[model samples]
Target: MTYYWFAQSVGVLAFMVGITMFFNRSDRRFKQQLSAYSAIIGVHFLMMGAAPAGMSALLNSLRTLISLRTRNHWIMVIFIVLTLVLGLSRAHHWVELLPVGATVVSTWALFRTSGLTTRCIMWCSTCCWVFHNIWLGSIGGSLIEGSFLIMNGFNIIRFRRLQLRGIDPFEVEKKIVKKMEENQAAE
Candidate 1:
């Protein structure tokens, strides 16, 4: 791959890293890293002479990683399979899915719990990404996705803190305040 391709791949990888930091909500290190990564991605996205397909792959991967319901295995499976089927394209459009297969399934695997449901899906995605990458003879997207697994692992750690403290991580600040007020009035 060219320098431009590496930069573009890493640049797209950076946006998802930023998402991991935001979700962590309490880790300064993660926040800084995420910011740095996001900036890199932005720079690459703006400056790199990359194919539009690569950019699309990055955006699509971001959607899968950030979208909550994608925590499910079935979606990951379907997406992976769709990516695989698209690989039949002789025009190399299939290569575009490289980043997406890695990032999406990897992110999903990281966020989901250890239950059979989550396990089944992550494993499935892994399989799909592996099979498809081999078919395309590229590792760029898988490498991108692997980074998400690491970043997302940190995100899961941060989420565990909220879980232990008995707060819904997704509950907004005002909702928490309302709950507190209701409790005080009840008392």
Candidate 2:
């Protein structure tokens, strides 16, 4: 019981991190934070004895980090294959495959897409995770993914609004960089 509580505590922490991650308007910052959140959630699942979900989350952490550096389709394929092999090997039930599926979708989105498309794809992944968490009786996990669905939905709408205004959603990152450079130059 104590062990389970500890796992739940970690899930709560992950919930906070995930909420912050999805709230970011900058793609780069979102990916950066998401990498950390994946690792934390991986630990939470592992401690809960869900090996497949834990493995998928850990792989997702590395995959997200790598995605920040390149959007190469080949690299994405490698991650997908690795996730399937690792996740399926430990999966004992259909519910266990949910995390694997979520990770695969995320791998494709992060490596082959950007901005609004990426978030939209991730919304599907989040749904998979929410179902998996609920099936596994992970209180923290369910809350985290549920919150993620709502937060991610808001971000998608925000991105769409930016698009409707004739502004590229990713342009926000460029504007931040430009302002930072200007400040440095002024100094």
Go through the candidates in order and give the clash count of each.
1, 0
Residue lDDT tens for model 1, 80-156: 55544443332345544544454455445534433223334443554554444345433343443454555455555
Collision pairs in model 2: none
Using all chains and alpha carbons, the TM-scores for the candidates as numbered come to 0.36, 0.89
| Candidate 1 ranges beyond 4 A from true positions | 1-82, 88-147, 173-187
Poorest 10 consecutive residues of model 2 by lDDT? Answer: 176-185
Write the residue-wise lDDT of candidate 2 on 1-187 in tens digits: 5988999999889878887788787878898999888999999999999999999999999999887666656788999999999999999999999899999998988876667788899999999999999998888789989999998998899879888999886876656545554664676
Candidate of highest lDDT: 2
Model 1 TM-score, all chains together: 0.36
> After TM-score superposition, what is the CA distance of residue 142 in candidate 1 from its true location, in Å?
8.0
lDDT of each: 0.45, 0.87
